[model samples]
Target: MWHLITAPILLPMFTALLIMLPPIHYSPNRRRWVSMVSSAIQLVLVVLLLLQVQQQGQLHYAIGNWQAPFGIILVADTLSVVLVCLTSFLALGAICYGSAGEDEKGSFFHPLFQFQVMGINGAFLTGDLFNLFVFFEVLLIASYALLIHAGGKNKTKAAVHYVVLNLTGSAIFLIALAVLYGTTGTLNIADMAQKVAQLPASDLMLVKSGALMLMIVFALKAAVLPLQFWLPATYASASAPVAALFAVMTKIGVYALLRVYTTIFGSEAGALSGIAADWLLPAGLATIALGAIGVMASQDFRKLVANLVLLSVGTLVSLVALQTQQAAAAALYYTVHSTLVTAALFLIADLIANQRGKAADRLVSGRKVVQPVLLGMMFMVGALSVAGLPPLSGFVGKVMLLQSVTDPDNRLWLWSLVLLSSLVVIVGLSRAGSTLFWRISGSDTVAETAKPLQVFAVCWLLLASPLLVIFAGPLTELSLQAAAQLYDTNTAVQLILGQEVTP
Candidate 1:
């Protein structure tokens, strides 16, 4: 049963290798079956792992039978396992959508897709900071290839920008890791948490610098404020499924911040306590402002959805910045809602674009979709969710976030910004919906109907919105438990380090 901790990472990796082998490599049908089956199994394993975490506290697996701070380790707690499950579930929808026909647009699409899942899963599961970096590279490399799949000039340009920015971030990440390793003498996060507590006064500045640098890297990944310029064009240019999966990619940054800060630099860390919250809250607010502007200004549907992703990032970061159990619970719930909602919008945008003929996804009056009734309904649900309207998970998440903040200053800032930004999103999406569906012009001819599998994929992801609302009680309870686990650094240290290490 302990071996299940590594299955999420290993399954996709082996599936990717299998997809690249002779029989499956040549048969597209075979590749699709393999990818889809692998993703399903991965999802099931992670769910079971989540159940285990609920039954048994935090679980750890020492690779090669070596313990933490000595060899590789994988740890599964509530937070990490939930995220791993989300990754696999999302990947299943994406791969199912691609199998409809998008996989044929490029070589090794199945393999690259499997590898990307592997990297994402590994990133969520690994206990070592260095292994996290390795997983980041793996995912980034696969994304580089996936971004340019069925290459076009605009995609090429976007890929170039994405590659350059992440490469720079990777460099900074490496430098930060070096400094932390030098100062703390360990890269295992649990062990680092132990070491960071007992650091000498003289080395405090260096450790602080390293920690902030790592935050900067994560901020870049999260697309927070000033560093977010690259995301709009890049996401808008990728294929639908790729963009959908990339939704979870951004959340990885938020996850890292929540995990690292709460575990290692919580109130127990003396002068360095809550080091990220001050910078993050303001940055998150600014990001919301920026995203609102982008959503209104966007002329392309995909680009509009991309900006919405930015808006969700802002919301999640701000909730995390609050650093309370309630806030953390809200952040977790919102993370799930936002990721699925945005991914659905991307897939929905692609559906509209495919059906709009020459106008594509541009925000202009054109022919209505052949199945306007179906697509319009889906778009409405997605738009309402994105706007944080009632009867959907988005509304629930926003309410949770609003109720979580107690500080007058934080409430003023968060309430004002979140509400105002949501208003802007509603207006932007309203304009988009009218233009795409209601304001029909030109020829009555619509493009070919969307593939059934594609529609199914969109429906699958979007279904989470209503389901989340229905199961809010149990889900939010799990989130609260996850949050409590994160802040209880002492229990975490003992579980992972296998010895009493004072927090």
Candidate 2:
């Protein structure tokens, strides 16, 4: 049980170190094998942790057996565990996709990939705010290296933009943390939540300001609307598998907002109670509108998928702002749905580009791709899944979100945006697909081809959304259970404080 809690973080950390050792310094192939084995082992560990949370119902492991509030702690709640599992699944497919020469694009691609996973896993498990910042920086540094891995002019510019924006966000994150710590004298989340109510009146304003600033940092990470200007180029500029792995990176921000806001603030946040409610919904709606427009304007497959990521973030944040358990559950299910399909879409775009030869994923009528029937088929499913078309988990996730927000105030507003944006996505995807597949007239020209393992990786990811549909009932229940754990403020606070934990 303890091993389940620590393995995801520890395995990847050691794997990265092992890859760096002089013995393996010369062999990229060996490095890749090491990373793949580590990813597989992490996936198994994540699943085991998820199962443990299911049986034990929200577990916590204080590092070195030190009690919380004094030492670092790792939590295994339903929400954290579910995200760990999602991260591992994406890592596996993305690593496999990269294995087919994507890792060879840079000097330390395999090692950087391991550190990225380690940071993501650490973010999901850490029970304190300071560690969150540390992990965020770890992943950001790794990703910056990754963004410009193949040394593109465009990727370099995008990395500059990404680095500048995230560096600003990180500085702000520290200020917010300082404020929270100054007010409450503890950086531990559970302790802060418990101590918030007891803060002197003089410190209340600073706490509220800190909380608001924290959300701003998270929004920057999630890339919603105005803050989203940094995302499109950054994602579109990366090599395929790095971009695919990144599909889950923005989601880490979403996960933070979901976990922290609900857990730390909740209904009892006092002046902070409705901190995000007022503007978040409206901002989220604007993000959806803007992303839909971006999708329509996009001239290439990479850009289209990039905007789809923003669109997905908009939809999730809008529903999340509703502040209901139902919304959390829907958001969780949708998170899984979106991450898998987004990865598939990125890899599919790269694969399609390979097949299209001179056409090369441009949204124009050009030469046909050689032997791309399966690739085209995968793209269609992926696009539908992104557009929230029926029977797939994407549709089910949206329905769950809709069902959650049936109140008069949000119902009409959310429904209109969801349905309307989805239609716009459908049209944009249809236009892109039609121009690429149907409008083209000539035979393949360049004849570039995708590796079998790369195709298998893409297919493996594409299958997750449909499989979610097959297991929708059980999965939704698990999501609801996770959301319940998230909302159960007392249970978490008590568990982390080393008080007798609730079942």
Candidate 3:
């Protein structure tokens, strides 16, 4: 059962190798079938692994039969399992949707997609910081290839900026890792967490600085405000399925932040105290405000989805800053909701644009509503969900988050800012919603019929999202347990405490 964690990480790579064989490469249709079959199998493996972890608790598998501190370990705790499931679901969805399009048949597409999944699963499962960094590179490199896969002028331009920015972030990450290893003398995350508290004040400060640098790197990846300029542009220029895949990529950053901050640094009471909550809370609020404004101002529907992605990051960041179990749980819930919603919206954007072009006879009329009734319904649900309206997954997360901030007595203004930002997000989402779906031209003749597979994939995911709201209680509980595992090293300590604990 424990080995199931490794299956999700290995199956894709194995399948990739099989697909690259001569016979498989000869037929494009066969290649597509092979990729789809592989993805479907991987998805089932992920779901089964998730169930195993949920039922039996944390699953640990050491690579090459070596123990921790001396060898690499793969951990499938609730948090990692949840992310694994999400990556599989989104990857499968994107592959399904993309398969229905012409570009999906490109020679490199299937391989890169599988490699991306491998990277994501590896990142989630790895218990070593260095291994995580390696997986990060793997994921980003695949993304770089996919982003420019279309080879258009727009994609090329956006890819350049994306690569340069991420490379800089990677440099900072490397420097931080060097400093951390220099101070702690171990690359294993569990080992580092144990030793981090024992370091001298100066060394601890260095580690904190290193951690902050890492946060900046991830913030850039996650598209947190002030570092989010490149995301909208790059995502807008990429193909829809590619953009949908990028949605899961941002959550990887969020996952790292949650794992590192709570599990490693937050364990050190002194270190956590030095970085006061006030500092992060305000910045998070500012990110939320900026993201809302970005959405409100954007004219392009694709760009609007990009801005909303940023807003989701802001929400998660704020919850992390709060640093409470409830808050972390809220962040977790929102993370799940945001990923699904963003993916759904991107799919809808593709459908709408494709339909509009057909309806307008390929005239490039801007923002025309081809199927007003269907467009109106989806837009209403999607926009309202993004805006955190009631009876949706977003609303549940927000309400929980709002209730978790205990400093209202002393920081009324901060709470006010949070509320104000929520209102601003509502306004921004509403404005975009009305303009893109409701107020746009209502010409049915020009609307082209979307591919059944693409429509089915999008609608299936969108429909699944409301289930998050329905099952909020169980999901929130899972998140809370995961957050507990994150913030308390006692869990890890107990797991290996009786065994060999030495590095």
Please tell me which model should have the higher TM-score, number 2 or number 3: 2
lDDT of each: 0.91, 0.87, 0.76
- Tens digit per residue, CA lDDT, model 2, 1-503: 66679898889889989999977767877887888888988898889888888888888888888888988888889888888899999988999989889888787888888889989989999999999999999999999898999897999999999999999999999999999988889988888777775667888899989988998999999998789999999999999989998999888888888777776776756656667777679888999899989999999989999999999999888877888999999999999999899889999888878777676888977777776587779888998898899878789998998899968978988899989999999999999888877877676486757787798889889889889999999999998998898888887887778553221
CA shift at 171, candidate 3, in angstroms? 1.4
Tell me the lDDT of model 2 at 372.
Answer: 59
Best by TM-score: 1
Candidate 3 residue pairs in clash (backbone atoms < 3 Å): 358-446, 359-446, 359-447, 360-446
* Residue range 388-425, candidate 1, lDDT tens digits: 99999989999999999999999999999999998999
Off by over 4 Å in 1: none
Q: Give candidate 2 misplaced runs (Cα > 4 Å).
A: 441-443, 499-503
**Residue 196 local lDDT, model 3:** 77
Kindly give the stretch of ten consecutive residues in candidate 1 with the minimal lDDT sum.
Answer: 494-503
By TM-score, the better pick of 1 and 2 is 1
- Indicate the worst ten consecutive residues by lDDT in candidate 3: 358-367
What ordering of candidates by lDDT runs from best to worst? 1, 2, 3
